[model samples]
Target: MPIKAQMEQLQRVTSLSVALEWVTGCPDLAGRDTVLKLIGEEVSTTIQGVIYSAESKGGGGAEMA
Candidate 1:
């Protein structure tokens, strides 16, 4: 997928794991190492963000956006 399209998708997806699973299982995307690597990096970054947000939530009032 093109970067423009990817950016659009990034705005909508709520779960990187599920997106990764879908990408990995995609017939058109099979055997593409670069795409897999990009997906992994995205997932890792997203997970870190979630972890930090959870840990730093103030006054128990913070919720996922």
Candidate 2:
């Protein structure tokens, strides 16, 4: 499959949790699966860090008048 298809399916079929679970299930995965897993982890970790910082900072800098 192509990267285009993978991105589309990411929203529809696997979801982040399912992809992470798939990654954990295999230690020697390769190809598209590895690419998808890497992307997922990268996004997940980044989002987590953002949320943590926001909580620590209180209102996360999103305050509105």
Candidate 3:
């Protein structure tokens, strides 16, 4: 399949975790670097959100005024 079709299929069928796994396992996949970079950013953002939520609840962060 062409790159566009592969991407559309992924969007239609895979969740984020599954997509990441598929992309990692497919070394020859087109746009693999771009996909990995995007996935990394997504995971980083999710982690940041969780950290911020925890800190807001007094789990350890800057003092809340």
Question: Best candidate per TM-score, number?
Answer: 3
Please, what is the TM-score per model? 0.46, 0.45, 0.56
Give the alpha-carbon lDDT of every model. Answer: 0.58, 0.57, 0.64
Single out the weakest 10-residue window by summed lDDT for candidate 1: 56-65
Runs in model 3 deviating more than 4 A are 1-15, 27-30, 59-65
Candidate 3, poorest ten consecutive residues by summed lDDT? 1-10
What would the per-residue lDDT of candidate 2 be over residues 1-65, giving only the tens digit for each residue? 34454455445444665666666666565765776767677666655655565555566546522
- Candidate 1 per-residue C-alpha lDDT over 1-65 given as tens digits, one digit per residue, 9 for 90 to 100: 34454455555345655666666766764455666787678866755554554556643425544
Question: Cα RMSD to native, each candidate?
Answer: 8.3, 9.9, 12.1
Prediction 2 global C-alpha lDDT: 0.57
Pairs with backbone N, CA or C atoms under 3 Å apart (clashes), candidate 3: none
Model 1: colliding residue pairs: none
**Using lDDT as the measure, which candidate wins?**
3
TM for candidate 2 is: 0.45
